[model samples]
Target: MDAMTSKGKPSPRSSVRPLSNEQVARLGERHNLVDVTRYYPNGPRMPDAPEIGAQNPRATARLLEGVSIVMRQRSRVKAWGYDRVPTNGPFIVACTHVAMYDVFIPMMSIFHQGRRPRFMAKAEMATWPLIGRWFQLVGMQPVERGSGKALAIESESIRILASGRPLTLWPEGTLTRDPQKWPMSLKPGVGIIALEASRRLGREVPLHCSATWGAASINQWWPWPRRNVVSCFDDRLPYGDLLKDMGAWGDEPPKELVDELVRRVHLRLVALLAEIRGEEPPAEGYWDFRTMTRKPWPQDFDWRIGSSALATETPTDGVIGESGVDPGLNMVDKGAQS
Candidate 1:
């Protein structure tokens, strides 16, 4: 067993030890008791299980739209690319997430464009203090990260898109872990869900790439008289043909197929980041979140976006194999946000 130090801190040897079920249970009543579920059935009972979220999404969408209108006005937010968004049908809006507060940017932008956005958000949001219920009422689908419920989330997401509402998902899943905060490698679930949605609809669901910068200012707790721009790139993906071409439309998509789809999305995200920064990006590669060690943000107040050194880093092998790992669907380490 690993030892603890005199200061109540873990010893160096105790840093990353694995625990048995019995040992884990003995650590605390919360861990030891399953009887707590009798009182709080949905409250962290079987904490590792995947939760699919509340039923009845359309009703929630209605309430969320009303709430976002007030938030939009207060934030003084603006959006570019109304022409780029689809006006008549169901579509997928894939965006880069830099800050949790910035989720409002996409919410307001899409709302003003005449569509309600159904987000595939973290399951914890359903139980967050004040806004947890609001999240459920907004038709946000909750997902337990890394519980192997990605396919469950994808199924629900496809249903939301089929309903003709714009479904917004952060392909990065979490904030950019890049030292420079440029867009990182995207999770493949967005591509997979878009493909599946298009297959169900008998046509391609347009995938719009959105990049939101300046939202980082909100993290400093002084958001505004300053501006936050939500830029929706003009490039839209015809996912149906792309999927068929890559052989992803079959009963089971191969690992290479999904990787290629994610790669295509990553390239476009990099281009969008370059456009937002008003500078040229690295010639061939970007920082891979799976393998890169992220740098912490500055301690003082600074509104500038973080970025990485322009090095040609290749994606690490074995980081994600045929069974694609959805890091966004995996555990969230909120340290990246700070």
Candidate 2:
């Protein structure tokens, strides 16, 4: 157990802790504990999972078109790259979750860019009455929570990837609501699925980061709207190279590849968020989340993305690997918009 003695402030360490084996057993029990099956016995107790979201290209494309009409008339918001996302693919769209709106606007942008996005929603989210149904309609699926849930998510994600469709997942697991003030951390296990899929498909899966800024809340889509910008990079960072450049844990130079992949995503996320904010990112020592899977940084190791380093223009020459050719351009088929 670790403890900080200097302050009365709440520890940045999550209060959510490791579950005991007994707790795990209890969790399994509670999974179907109050079986509503007795009353509705014929069907599922919770609502059906959604399939229309980031997964259903046709629906997302249609939805984004409508959002574009609304955004067109709005003066405070700016959108970039409604032209780069692929219309169909086995790709991963990594996004930053700051505000609740962090999701919708980006989805709208990607939809306009020509790819559909499927995202993981909390299991509780699926149980909501009307809103739950909407999530399913939009391709949102319930992600069973807890450490044990990782395998379940991984299994489902591989199946999703195999379908040759795109899926959006938060490595952060949830939003980085106050990332600037504190360390923005992400769960490291996310890389496992990315790597497995690449190995199974015998190709590096496509990974891209879309960072957002200046949006207030997710629900404030109406009114004049807050000044916001959605930036998409055509970076084709590979599942393996991402881990390599980002520095994941390794033993024989390739075995801990999953650790390496997660590490890379964390590193890139730091860069992406820093670029979006146009500010110096928190120091490496302060990035507790990234350090979760690797060695802690020395005090002088800088990780901040400074204003001097922010890309004034998107990188035309984006990341690449053994993949035949990198699609590192701001050009997705406009037919994707339809």
Candidate 3:
């Protein structure tokens, strides 16, 4: 979620001036933000935002779980590999963000398996009228995407893990821009969290990758007449073993570790997606955010039944029609993560 001030604007860091250590200290004490000066002087910090499941009692979480159950029923979601979810301890669930409907599918999957999920969501979502309110009630973590709140988000995430709660993250940061709905290049933040959380718990954290396709079929929050197919890759990436291979036990691993960690998860996600599609994944594996230029699947675009004729229509610059499709050359310039 984006960090907002009393004025409901971006935090001061949104300006060119860098944040100070004292400011950082205040954030740490308040928002559960982590101080990682040695790693990144101007790195992201956790925002001092309210989280639903962060410190609340089980009663609230149960209520949210009930909501998930109802949503699953209404959506008629079909999920696979849910039994593979580890029920005994805290684990990381990295998912693909194809459409808005993607959120409900995993929540239902994990909820059906008897676990509540704390999602790392965008900060802006917390400001949306009703959906934002629901997000908080469900204990989703709101994070400012590129306003440099990564460390702070990680701090809160570690706290959640320490509390023995399952946390879900969309490592692609934002909705995928892969026109074909393939996975995008994975971000290293998830790797950082997995590595650090494993160290803090003094045990390896199992990282599970789950991919949901056809969400676009039920896109735009419309659940009727479409069913989502979810695949939970049973093979959990043993982050502990990966750390051991890099000789990073009990200490902060080198920065390079993030790359390897992201690469592994990205590959696994691609493979799982291949299984869902019953075909070999692209030889290139996934699109790299640094170079790829594609538009996100429309939030209201039910690609399963909707025609691309509207999508292909060319429009003038910076104006979207009623369907929210750019209709112009819908290329996205690389910006901050999500």
Candidate 4:
């Protein structure tokens, strides 16, 4: 049985519960808004523009300048957790994609924090007018989708991390088609890259997930009364345990391990989004991009549970044995509870 809208069309199920006027107002009070248009140009600048590998320095500067102009004139940006970003070293930032313009929010936020991380974007973005060419010149790794070259992409991502550079990726692969704009199921390549790169470098890579809200409400054409855009960057997600058994698995990590890693990233993004929106995520479940349906949340799973409680007890053969429990939550780490 499916739900129907007043127009007699089937309504898509959503996990997001809408917020009331009072709730939205209360959430609004917590933000410390900065009018980017007024403050950005005069604000403290990064001591020196960190080199972005082989990217064209002049082009990267110009591209960022243009992005700053558009963002400042169109919206106010509020971001936190920059201090949590490692000042130096290799790290991965997986961010949520709510809207097209939202990409710049995290890009600028990371730049402001004085780290110049390369970004993974669709290959088509390299062809966009005005900024497309600049994107390529500014460390954008263009991903060619559905081309049967996933391994190549994954290798390149791992290479970047192994080279001691920061990498930012929108793991959802595209703007979320979630009816409520919540993050959808992520591509497994993010998990694969994180795990493989760590093995190559002999340490767990610092992986962070970030969520942004407010840009979706803005009309890019006639921007005014600048919307309050807020972004939250989480500290490193707990994944050291995932790497402990890597040696036993030989070359390819098990599908179950990769899937569990992806699950953790998805859950973390969902939690961060809930905090930013001040609305609880759909308790019913998360949206599945492939099936275009809402799946039930893992049985007894709580978004507030610490990372340890979220770890999966991955079984061999890449499938969860029937224990009548969600494989993703078969075991809870009592020691890791927050």
Please give, for residues 233-303, the per-residue lDDT of candidate 1 as tens digits: 33464334355553444674555656655655665666655545445544334656655643332243121
Summarize candidate 4's per-residue lDDT along 138-214 as a digit string, tens digits. Answer: 77898877546678888899999999888999888777877777888788988999999888887777788888877
Q: Candidates' lDDT values, in order?
A: 0.51, 0.49, 0.55, 0.68
lDDT of 4: 0.68
Q: What lDDT does model 1 reach?
A: 0.51
Model 2 alpha-carbon miss at residue 18, Å: 36
Higher-scoring candidate on lDDT, 1 or 2: 1
Q: Candidate 2, residues 51-106: lDDT per residue as tens digits?
A: 22335545544445555565545423434333344445577766665555556666
Superior candidate under lDDT, 2 versus 3: 3
Give candidates' CA RMSD values in order: 18.7, 15.4, 20.6, 11.8
Name the regions of candidate 4 deviating beyond 4 angstroms.
1-54, 305-338
TM-score for candidate 1, residues paired by index:
0.62
Considering only N, C-alpha and C atoms within 3 Å, which residue pairs clash in candidate 4?
15-282
Q: Is candidate 2 or 4 superior in lDDT?
A: 4
Q: What shift in Å separates residue 149 of candidate 1 from its native position after superposition?
A: 1.9
Q: Model 3, range 61-99, lDDT digits (tens) per residue?
A: 454445555555544444445545554467788888766
In candidate 3, residue 93 scores what lDDT?
84
Question: Which candidate order results from sorting by lDDT in descending order?
Answer: 4, 3, 1, 2
TM-score of model 4 relative to the true fold? 0.78
